[model samples]
Target chain A: MVQLSACLLRKIPGPPRIYKRLQTFRLNARYEGRSRNCYVVGQGYQLKSMQYTRVARKNKVLDFKELYNLRLEAAAEEHGIPFRYLWDGLRRMNILLNRKVLQDIAIYEPRTFAGFCELSKQHQVDQGLNLPPHSYPKIPVNTKGML
Target chain B: MHDRRRVLQWATFARSWWIFDANHQCPFQSANRLCLFLEGKHKPIYHPLSDCGDHVIVINTKHIAMPDRFWRAWRHFHHTQYAGGFQVQRAWQVHREDPTKILKKQIYSTLTGNLLRKGLMARLHLFPEEDVPEGMLRNVSNQIRQVMPVPKTLEDYPIEERESFPRVFEWPEEYVVKDGKEFERQKEYLDEDLSLSKLQ
Candidate 1:
């Protein structure tokens, strides 16, 4: 039970108890490959393992982004518009939305997403973008919505 | 008529930031996809006159794996007004100097018209590898995946499926193959040839 020093604790987030857990994971994530869990690893490799964890934490951002993009793309494909087009179409109609929200709408609120696409299709035809092979349902332009 | 319609469309357009991953993505395909964002071609309300396009922040540009031998065969040139200021670098060399240059250049060419190119390029942000500036990362709410599959490490694969991966054929015991020794021999040959070339 080697008690870690305060200087060693500098710049780490969470309580000391949580930091210990992170430190353990830092060593474990690397050492698990060789069947050496963090606790059994030697003392010298401690700080280095923590640094690896930091770098890996940053890299995890890319992982989340990759997931969000995949979901958005798949949902857009199902809606018969490439995700990019649908996103842009939404932008054109002043309906600002993010990939996560769009993905949720795609899965849970599909009719609403479709309605947004309908408006997007109307805008597309007005601007004359390259329409996909699938015929998009048009939003009926009415006198009431303009005001 | 066209200009008025463009203005009308722009009136209600609410812009946003988009992220694109260039890792292991083809430059041509990525450029085409990016062009839609730059030109606002993704929108039916897109037009030459209006700045209705959203911003794009691209990450993992350093890992762009060009197909075939573009690293050697491709060349980019630079020129200055001085009589002998012309310089050229191969794609590999360009990447070494600045990883984001090729991707930006590719995207720049994909976008149409000189008039809007500068403005459009202003909205395009690129980061080499995974390190993105806080400001660009802050604005990006969503991302677009590359059309093609991005290569992943062995650990990225699911543990359950790794063992279940199908094999096209299994080797017989008599047909055992040496691995590292053959690679070492080829590496030595290549090193010697490279050293000889350097001497020349």
Candidate 2:
């Protein structure tokens, strides 16, 4: 004959170490309660949420590309540098800076972007492009607008 | 050797400038929508602890709309620490005073409780109408329309000939409620008339 000892049963038992970690992994954290009733569904939900997050992570290329383009366009426009002219001239000179960098130079370091303007105009002239020439450093100087 | 995950990671941390057109848009919806961009919650790289939000330029704030009757009913209340400092102003009144305040406050409130909230709010540029500064307009490469239809201008209405058509209700030619006194007086009168009509 053998005797059995009584033991308390846990609703969803897991060691504290693993349980704490799973709790932290909740996607909609606000819905996580102390009851611990969601262990089964929680893991599945966490997985799905993570999967969506991965997709979102990968799609940022387009967003950044557009942002950089806008910044470059705006920065060039300020000094009366036509966007196409600046882009084309830079390409010709192999000054292949991304729009992200171009935008920074446009907003923060106007002087540097201005250099690009001079380069852009000079290149356009050398190439004999028919487009109306924009002056270098169109800054309150005499004979402005003549590249 | 382009890995999908690797490519996303590179883009995820980058930011962008967004445009929010508030013409005829519900303030709450637009503000919440802007919150996503401001907090970078829409990004795959969004971490609650990180600053991932993008810049947003809000235009046509002058035409932002609220549901019918909410303008009067929705009150923005405030108080000073002193006794009897409590005050409540209707939504329309506040909007009338400062066109950008309502949406700005909404978006600000929608941001999660984080240190980056203030910085994100700073990135939000609000303009009352289409007349944006040349500098700000230059950076805007795209536009995001609101979830609702654009408000039609008076010019969009069919010929003035249609103005004379009969309607279920019309504003009395002499109904002047520009002043609070006149408006209160009219409200009382309208209330009595409405009750009498109901009884009839």
Candidate 3:
């Protein structure tokens, strides 16, 4: 781990001074590759390709309606849980988490997403909340004053 | 006598009166009310065919109230194209540069969907500061008096109303109705006897 830390620092210079101070106190430091640059050795990661992949992932085409339906579908398909159980669990958790963030976690980090679902389930259990079958409301098409 | 009666009728018929103060917070509420009144929505005399509404003069627009977070959070968005092209500007930047322009833009947006919007907007007077020069005020006072009404809201009314509404223009009480320079000037304009050839 100490050798890994030296290699990482040598590859990406000029990290903030506060980060260097934190490194001294870190006993079991695990590097999370979320920063601007992450390096392993003299073989540096291609910065341009990393940025392109990030942008491409964001740009992946998904129909809005399909994406909305997928959330309930995926919960039932993967966990053998009903749509209501997952939804009520999410509501009970009271996380101000957006749908896009949940969708990203569900697609890329299934383990982390499963943990979130479990946390939400525990929250529902503690609150004694009952799940209701999900229903989509019909939205009125606003055509008034349209040119 | 008929003209005097008409003027009195106009004063009585005016449902709302607003006096904008430089010192007061939230002058836009008064501005919005004035815009609605000018749109002829408040008046019984309103006819769709003819444009008839009370004139509005917004005094001391420079000191208008702005929210504390307005400079950072408030952004006005505009698109250069029909699609994705856009630009954003902060409210404080617009205020610091030309506040009157910003006020006029807001007032115009509120007055939309009315045919008389342009005509009503033309009548709006925006003064940057409270102080009005005495000479200009005197010339314009008669016209101001024709439209000006008793103050209502503390938020809408001018700060000067607390001491008694100061007339923006007033004729000197000392001036007699003699054949003086002022009297002759008025007589020349009002002369029914004077022929067109004689005036020429």
The residue-by-residue lDDT of candidate 3 on B35-142, one tens digit each, is 645665443233445465555556667766655665445666677886756666666546656767667777787777666678888767677786755543443422
Clashing pairs in 2: A57-B44, A58-B8
lDDT of 2 by residue, B47-122 (tens): 5566777888998898888988887788787879799787777786678789998999888888877777789889
Specify the CAPRI tier of model 2. incorrect
Error of 2 at B84 (Å): 1.8
Residue runs of model 1 more than 4 Å from their true location after superposition: A1-79, A82-147, B1-11, B158-200
Docking class of 1: incorrect
- lDDT of each residue in A1-147, candidate 2, tens digit only: 333433444254667776565664455475556423466656666677779888888778777776566556545655566677788888887888977777766655668888887768766665667555444544432324444
Task: Please give each candidate's TM-score.
Answer: 0.48, 0.45, 0.34
Tell me the lDDT of model 2 at A143: 24
lDDT of 3: 0.53
Query: By TM-score, who's the top model here?
Result: 1
Lowest lDDT block of 10, candidate 2 chain B: B191-200
Ordered by DockQ, highest first, the candidates read: 2, 1, 3
lDDT score for residue B84 of model 2: 79
